[model samples]
Target: MSHAPVFDAVIHAPGRLQICAILSSVDDAEFAMIRDAIKVSDSVLSKHLKQLEEAGYVKLTKQAENGRQRTWIALTPAGRKTFAAHVAELQRLAALTAPEPMGQGFAG
Candidate 1:
């Protein structure tokens, strides 16, 4: 039987998916850190983050440290679980799509 592709929507977008992956690996990170990790412009990251936050996938907290303002980002428990499942599904898709050795399938 054939299997449908996983991560069809939210986790499929390149930028957002990258953001989710980065957040999944860390406990909590600052805006600058997440922006740098994703290598996206400030405005771009902000827009994407806002969407994630609204969807209840991420939490953002603004605080002051040593008189400096900082915005910290973290994945909620639900977000973590979703991201983990998305990643696993993507992995399975990759493995299934990979080219097999000779005699694996009919030639064109």
Candidate 2:
């Protein structure tokens, strides 16, 4: 059986949603991973990531390893919940726009 989602926002922005979706499926990922997945320039991704981070939907951490600093990102508990809810909302919206069953199309 299929279940609907319960997200609130539409999250239609390409890079932003992709970021959230990719991050949702991982425990944590590096900046490059996210940047590559979204296929955006470093500055572009950084701007979008900053927005998510400021919204409390993502967490960023910096650590030094072998004299180099690495940045990692992970969804917060709240971020996970918010992203899940937003995806659900999108599902419900899509359901509304889908064609009706045969012989019952175009409901007013």
Candidate 3:
């Protein structure tokens, strides 16, 4: 029997989903970069990042850069797997509901 699609509630939120997408494309991203990309305030991004971090789907590191502290974020191996599965499920659903091509089922 086919298995059900994997939909992780933790990563399902719009902001969190965007975060995962961004992290999946690169080795790591600065906290500010993700915030800007998601167009959220610092506190809002921090809240979402915290959730992902707690769920073991993201890793955050803080270091000094040019004498200033900066935070970098990246998805863990498990995060990548989970995100991929979630996306695959979404694609599958879309395909299942997609409309058929025109002029294929009717003949003049």
Clashing pairs in 1: none
Least well predicted 10-residue stretch by lDDT in candidate 2: 1-10
Whole-structure CA lDDT of model 1: 0.81
**Tens digits of per-residue lDDT for model 2, 1-108:** 133465534234678789889989998899988898788888998888888888888899999989998889998887788788778777778878957678976669
| Residue-level error in angstroms, candidate 3, position 105 | 20
Candidate 1 has its poorest 10 consecutive residues by lDDT at 1-10
- Please, what are the lDDT tens digits per residue for candidate 1 over residues 49-101? 88788878899999999999999999998777777777778788788785877
lDDT tens digits by residue: candidate 3, 6-53? 888999999999999999999999999999999999999999999999
**Clashing residue pairs, candidate 2?**
5-88, 6-88, 7-85, 7-86, 7-89
Please rank every candidate by TM-score, starting with the best. 3, 2, 1
Q: After superposition, how far is residue 4 of candidate 1 from its true place, in Å?
A: 13
Model 2 RMSD, rounded to 1 decimal: 5.4
lDDT at 87, model 3: 87
CA error at residue 56 for candidate 2, angstroms: 0.3
- The TM-score measured for candidate 3 stands at 0.86
